[model samples]
Target: MPHPRRTVMAVTSASLVALATLAATGSPAHAVDDPPSTPVPITTPDGALFSYVVNADTRQHTAAVKRAVRHAGGVVVQAWPQIGVVVAQSTNGDFRSDVLAGADGARVESVGATRTVPVSEGTPGSGGTTAYAEEKASGAGRTFDGSLVGATVADPREGEQWDMAMIKADQAHAVTDGRKGVVVGVLDSGIDVTHPDLAGQVDLDKSVNCSDAGKVDESLAGKTSLSGTHGTHVAGTIAAARNGIGIVGVAPGVTLASVKVVNDDGFIYPEYAVCGFMWAGLEGMDVTNNSYYVDPFEYYCEDQPDQYAAKEAVRRAVAFSTARGVVHAAAAGNSGTDLDTNTTDDTSPDDSTPVTRTINNGCHDIPTELPGVVTVSAIDQAGLLAPFSNRGLEAIDVAAPGRRILSTVIGGGYGLLSGTSMASPHVAGVLALMKSQHPTWSPAQLVAAVRAQADDHACADVTGAPCVGTDADNSYYGEGVVDALGAVS
Candidate 1:
């Protein structure tokens, strides 16, 4: 199951790096003028191969920082000088300290481990490799896979998608399925291009795998999607073709780019996510749907050094994409906890063992929490908020149908799954539709229009949870359920 992704306030802009650099002319990040005490350095156990995100003060500092990384016994897997972020891996437990202690480390801003476990996929550029064995799941009947109860015969399984009708996507389709040129980057595991509904829609040229140490590994595009169906499910919801073969997507006319960010272990690490967003910006994608949290930590705290550095690197990536005219939407989460009042988190450092730790609202789910990104929660078939959907009074931007959604799965088939993960793509599809209708609109304009046009659904307690806020805007359904009909209008 896709871990429920969630939200919080966005990180400050990259310009902050200009404001805060090493205190002394050449210091080892002992103290900064602002931001919580010097970021607590990350600890890598002896002999444990770990991945890291090293941020430089600015792009000008990137070269010096790279030299520092090599001196610290680390391999540079991917370097983004545009944002001054570098992805590296090393077995040396003293990499962080050593990097800061080096002569070339003066420009190094911060370094943090990207994962808790050893580099499972092995260091990139080496003979070391990982395999993605395709897993097939075909549906013969609706036992548990995809049995349609109210599906109309005209579109095969169209009626099974009550989510479309709830968001008024079915009605919006009459206006336009979406523009063919609008591209949505599905930043998840991988999108199955072989599926009948998606075959003609996915642009293979724009698709690339970001799982290989956050580098663009073209060979994995479209071919490795079967290893996990989550990305396929998300792609189906966004733009499954309207060929009358199976279910139609929220925007069947829009093109899709499988910016595979999830690795073989089903985790979306910071480096991979950085690769996905940077790619989206470089490819000029109109929008991207983020269904999974950047793993190792569901909530990366800005107060901690490692978490702060990694989280900032992701923020820079998202900011870069948004600046280049791409909009992002992400799941609010599945834990059902009130994001505004979150306390303890026990599921973090997920690539390894999870240990409960004290947390606060300051620690947040990235991309979703990053400012300028549209944060969304999930609603059920009844048009009510899904209990599993995390809600935040100020965090969530909009709500969309998510419970037991029937979407494309592996084996060129359909399956039913639910989560805020399923909900985000609906909004992503809507964004694509709005983008199609208003081609010259800026990302801010599209986001504002969607939030302003959502239907007002009155708040109602879900299983005694006592909804906070009114129908116009609330913790459960931010700006109420998204109005697809309003987008294309």
Candidate 2:
């Protein structure tokens, strides 16, 4: 962003030196808990398949864990030795306990059923065995060369993009649209590549459907639900082309990888999320934007063994991405509450009946709350914090224009959507610009620069919610509203 030239993490193989290293790291202390209860609440009905994550202590011990999974009548769908995580399906209600109690049990760290509902996508066969390998070998998605010589800078519908002006993306665009190779993975509902504005932006080879037990499907399609345009909307905000046909994105010169993690029921399960993150690293993504939290639980607590194990598996997958130099940005949430002083959760086990369970400091929002991820909150056109955004003096890393954002929707058209989900892509776009400018900068350096360059402001009094901290840093605004122009200048 500073118009500086530096070293580059250019290619996929060159980008992936430490996937094995991340897998080699012994299990985290938090994952080494005692045996959890068998037949965890909300388990599948007998003979009904449920997806689970079986984690071993390290990559070297994954074989034993795989054997344990088979012994418990579960079929290993996919085994990620790099993260010591195995995505499996089982009809046995006691698979969770049985997998961690036999002779090979000591080699395993923890086992967890990733969701509350029975498998809707069905169990694994051997067809998906080469999907990931084939995808990696096929090629990457589309990327811009940052050339504006004959390109139209102003899109036909850009007049409707107030969010761009709010974040100063308009000013940044004059400096540079972005770079040629930066790929931002959109981990959400599947993005529609056929959309006029996104056809040239989405990387089809890099995109995959992870909703089916973390299996990689090369023939990826759009969202299964009629109401699912979330991924395409977020992609438009990040890198929709600057063609005359439609609205432009914040970093129109970058590329997008549509990593579908949301299911037909509109849920983002832990296994899907883990697969998305891992795919980002394996595919050599520069950044990833997570607009939703893991399903069924608004908060995954460290004390709950099942929750902890599932969360830990996801964490390991994210760590693998980070180690490969992938920067991550995530939405804080739309619950309209303080994540710093979390109290109660009435939205857990969303696949089933939700109960108002008392929560505490041990609880957390996955991905957004995970280490090394930039947590963003939502704001409106007036520069006021969105009332529905989750605020936190501890959790939030930045703020961005989110409410009533105009971007590409599913019907090969444009629409307005809100929530922190819309805000995160703006940050991801800014990060892409930063990477394009300073290709060799470490992820930490980029994050620090983004924060330091933010437009700091006092907390908004509009929400009537308590605003803590000074203008420089506050619960409602984090460092402040993300400054696109500043990030690139």
Candidate 3:
């Protein structure tokens, strides 16, 4: 499968000045504030579907909001009183307007559709089966004779795991394999619990699929019944067991819980994402790895009410999760553009037709650019930035090996894949180790430790253009490559 390229626009100095002027004054005349006023009744780009994330004012009772939602021809899917947010769905065309009218003084802070995010697949030739074969043939499969850095390594394919070695996780394992009690949530397509490499390490009790609006179905958790391998691969990278069968993960002794949020079509809706994060907090998950971008818009701008509501819902969920002690890690993106600068997006409102619009720093990639999340970029085996990895000094926190990485896939199979998606798990696995070694550390402390311990890489010269930032911290390499040994020690 080809990785979905993030839609981006290069901004000129003129656009930047225009945006600054617009910011100082008011929104541009072309900016959209209200939906069309026609009584024809507007449906989603996909016709007749209505879903919303409604934030209740602090003074309003959640039960009253539920009644309002019902009166407006919508059903309250879930009521998260902790964050004052509610997920609702309706088939009525005038659902938003009706909800407001029915609620009257119920204090609805915001209401918008549950946006959609497409699956972020790996790009071909960057990493996949072909790269796996070449690395295997180039002596990467050399036997370790059951010992590495003074520890007995049992997994047969551990020798082929160049990514683990690159981050010194193989050496770190000698110090501590990890504590079993620490749970890392894999929020992606789903995991394959039956895989030998991940058998005993998966926490089934905490796993749930939030694909449906109001249900928590465990049966939906795990590999997609229709050939999805992303989640299984991610799980293996975090806690694949040391059973001498496939490969060992960075933190082999930790537990993995699947919070399946993506659907069969590989799209992650905002409702599912909100549920996953909220669940992680309630379940006391120590960490989570998010490799996909939330969609409908790549960069949700605050000035746009529709986009702002979606961003606010996600932000509240993440904030709730963070306050409850979940360390969140996410991929920067595969766009290969600088996130700190002005850019235009041509792929937003993806649930329907996309329209090109200019965006500045005011707009952001949800969860990644959100506060307190550890944003990670991708580096190749040679410690250089991956050609497709997103870069931003303000957004990226660390870099990890993502190119041509190998791990467990569906059906007890092993394969290679690449992307910033591949890089995120390396950092997640390291966080698991850090959590195991220092259970009392808060999420902020863990993030600081990871950044402080990363191996500093100076900016690289790419395609006759010099990379940005210094060796200590740069847009391309962040705080440099993640070091598992440093994390564990």
Candidate 4:
């Protein structure tokens, strides 16, 4: 990590110009403006689906609720008044009987009110006891009441989540026939095995909670609220279960393996990050998506043997795994600055004497700055670069949809979220499509495909934008927004 001054000074003239242009012109494409007020139903590449939010907390009498829903011909998906989460479905696309009938005054907010249906074998309540109790008490074994009953429906990538839409649209060419499969390892927090949106897709058998394995107390199950929503969201984006009711992911047919590294505090111990990479490598995963980096305050770049050792370990692991055909993708930190840190002068931007700030604080620097990683930046639905995203000519590899992005959530729900955390999945999802298109593609070949087909444009002058095509290589925007339709072909 270098001081902010040095980080800013590292910006070359060409890179600056590109940044200026990107900011003015926005990203290469346009954001969807007329997306309906209701959430858009989506299908994951795997066939898993998701719907919108339904207010079921108001439903009091359990029997009355069932009868009402049955009268409307709607099937109650799942209910959790404690968290005010309920999902219902209708195969015929009838909104009233499907989501609003049984539960009186139940304001159906999203598209069809998505419900998660777990297809993973073994225990149905493996995610946590909290989730189990909610489902069990909601009449798990009862039959529908009658015409009021609505069959459960799966909706994938609902809402105005245009970012995921683009990614999914790209995969159609590679996986429409379902002849190929790709596994992506999401190294983040833990995943919710019982999430309905993740129905049929969570690889519970291979899932592990490495944060604090033996910390369960007598009063509670061996679980923590911080079980890994981040990982769950990333997994849903990559390959959510493709059954028919919840939101669909870009590569729903692909397999997702969860490997927890970051904790509730979102701080990933370098050692855990390294171990995650190593394990994913051994598992023969096709791609690995890392949406987090060491927090700036916790970054150690100088006089810290332990910190450097951890970084080196991760770097080595990345190299080893990539050599075996795993495409490693990491977010290029959230800080908006020039990421080049190897400075010739330790002085401030004013050319004053060097200070400690010039030597060791993580300024514009990021873990994505490391070599051999496909470091990505963030872009909005309108194809504009996110203002908070970091940039550098030599450090970044590419850009993707990151702002106001939508994906799966805990306890079978969905919402709008922003961050490079969201953007990285766009690339990972595209990579899955690439692998399916060319099952025999090497890691290098995949990278080449993306670079060659990227949109070469700049968005430098308009607030925060990507810098693309200003140079033969990449500056701030890398090769530019990844083109799923172009890259796969």
Candidate 5:
């Protein structure tokens, strides 16, 4: 099964109410000095530490909030004034309570810990094995004695890449292979920058790792520290080089930037996500591909103080990025639950022991459910909805090939994988193509064009319940499979 990815808050009822009111209404006026042009990292005390996002009324309130954080025995780790969200850590287990009770808390909107968000790749064996291992297992290289060789092969496997032709990317390439000016940020584990298919296609200058304290560390860019190949696969699907040596991407001409967010253990935290989005906006990236969900809680509910704070901080970061013209694309998840209907979430608080709870539509998958995000579902080779893909008319904005996808992986090899994770990069690549063709178009305009150009796919009658919605729009197919030719033209 697609294991739920793993990875807290303190506030009084009255203070919570006040913060809720602040969220509803605009912040009160207050002034402080300007924040640094770049994020400044602060060290936290040793011990069991917790991450928190302190929402301020204004940039001027940042100093006061910092002071309050210090007085409360907490340390400021990173400050993002562009969205008025601060990343802080403290050994005090009651950091949230202390901040809310302090004088500076009055100037803040909400303070909650940065929850863990794991990058879910769907069921094991669903996407087959890792590309590197698969190639070696299949004896991709055989010596004269019939023994398997460990040497890498230069197989592009172009004919097997049906997903490319399904979206008509090959035909679209003739019209425009994408522009060099356009860039797509792959916000996932990390990319194999040295791969033959992605060597010159990566923009190292724009790439950075945001896996810690919401600070952008250029030194960590393109480094996968772990053995995971998810980020490399995603990057290949988006902008792998068209060197006629390996698999070609939807927009092979566009540039890609690796925004490493997933840690060595394959977990994605809130701080990393926030930093990735903020950095993308600041760098003027045309589109961002989000292949995972922020974890700890699969659905962040408003009734829960900690979950509410995480949602608010992420929502603000996404809004800030979208406003800057970065089109955000995320996976719809592999839970197979209908997002439009009221369903119970049994995998919440994934960082610890998961508790089965009866959750309704009020609880949402952050980023995917947030406003202005381009949510993508998965489809199989025959234009059928993937069994593992989450479906809902309300949350799904588009559909793309995701099952048994063949793409570049680490070690300059190729392999087959599946999940909504694979599906998201397809849409992100199309967005890049569209951006290249229409450089002056806004994010809203690009989204509208993407949805409008899709080829309609009707739901099929299969096991369980039949598909819902009409041909115009449906819970399974969204606006139908994305069309690359249509996107570029």
Candidate 6:
């Protein structure tokens, strides 16, 4: 049963407010210095990776960064605070730029221009750059740390009234066949390359991993983690490569790419995730899928200010990408309470007592809360909202099949799982279908379409008797369950 007392804040409004303010101001509202206009670069002759530290404090140091890049015979490609600037072709291979560098600041941020993986088969515009796959682990339908089991539907599922079967039954209406040319990007763990169900169907030719700072690997390869399977499952749902076996994705023909950002522990540090978002933007991916989010109950209200700051930064990154035409989809979050109002009671954990709920406002609660991103929740096989699914009446824009969802696992076999995590991919797959049909839609337009054509039927009534009827987007079911048929139409 769904836990009624838990409140997860689907706070997407704050994101938009930040974006609007940014646009109006025409500059960043965060604390920091301006980046160098003509930063230099530094690189090693062997092409092997090297590490360096810099001063992240002042203006003269900023000039020093440029001088360092020039002195090293390399050009500054990228620079970020807490992250070092990447330069190419330095004479001695030593580079410095204080735009944000410090002596003790050994922050291993990535720098340098992202390289595009070469294309093998399809036309450039047809599929664009693709994401590849990497190692797979065992166990399906679980969390990255192997700490929890995702939600699943019961046989004839408790919520059969609203299930993927229904979507498949109505697939014809949901998707259209056309030379629309959409490129869907899966930004998660990594795919199960050996899954028979999603073999050749995947466009391994265009995969990339943006986790180690900003290195983009075309093979969609990544370091293995319990969180890795999340990417694989999302990818399978979106395109799975149409090989003869396994299940067919929502849009089997569209091209797919993976931008692995979330680590094995399911940690999506804002800076890293933002870097991935930036790279995808530069690559021009049509739609990007984000299945992971921070567990909100990890921090306290005192930290809310800092949390909002990080969220603002991420929001900037998402807006930066979407402005370039990439669409990002994220989970609403797993916390069962409003992020703004739900504060911990400050009870000390007893010996046998588990840490049931703690709040951490610092982490980006969910990328869903970021601006220009589509926030999704989950639904069950019977068309009822999953008990564990986070509610965001007005905050979430769509919902999808998240319960007992069966998809590719690392070790090749398939498994079932639940959670808004599982539900998020269904929406990703649907976006792929949309891109396949109408590849030209902008991020905002895609969002608008999903909202305008959503099946508001299953939405939760956050303020009523038994809470069952029409109401604005509430905490229980955001925009109700996502109806692919309704959305695409």
| Top TM-score hit | 1
Taken over the whole model, the C-alpha lDDT of each candidate is 0.78, 0.77, 0.72, 0.51, 0.73, 0.48
For candidate 2, the clash count comes to 3
Point to the candidate with the largest lDDT.
1
Give candidate 2's error at residue 189 in angstroms. Answer: 1.0
Per-residue CA lDDT of candidate 6, range 421-484, in tens? 7677667666666655566677787777766665666443433212332543545555555656
Looking at model 4, residue 314 earns an lDDT score of 49
| List of clashing residue pairs for candidate 3 | none
TM-score winner between 1 and 2, please give it.
1
Q: Is candidate 2 or candidate 5 better by lDDT?
A: 2
Give the distance in Å from residue 120's predicted Cα in candidate 5 to where it truly belongs: 21
Residue pairs with backbone atoms closer than 3 Å in model 1 (clashes):
5-333, 6-332, 10-371, 39-305, 40-305, 142-147, 296-349
- Give the Cα-based TM-score of candidate 2 against the true structure: 0.85
Residue 179, candidate 1: how far off, in angstroms? 0.8
Q: What TM-scores do the predictions have?
A: 0.87, 0.85, 0.83, 0.60, 0.84, 0.63
lDDT (0-100) at residue 358 of candidate 1?
67
TM-score of 5: 0.84
Off by over 4 Å in 3: 1-42, 45-47, 104-106, 116-151, 219-227, 464-466
lDDT of 4 by residue, 368-405 (tens): 65555788888777776677776666666888887765
Instruction: Give the lDDT ranking, best first.
Output: 1, 2, 5, 3, 4, 6
lDDT of 3 by residue, 1-489 (tens): 211112112244644554454333322211232122111112443235566877665524566767777887777888888887788877666666566567442456566666432122212222111111212111122222332322355677888899999999999998888898999999887887767677677788888887666346667423233226787777888888776667889999899988877665556667777888988999999999988777556777655555656777788889999999999989888777778763667655555555777775347787788888899998898888888788876668999988888888767778888888888899999999999999999999999999999999899855533467788998888898999999988
- Tell how far residue 66 is off in model 5, in angstroms: 2.1
Clashes of 5: 6
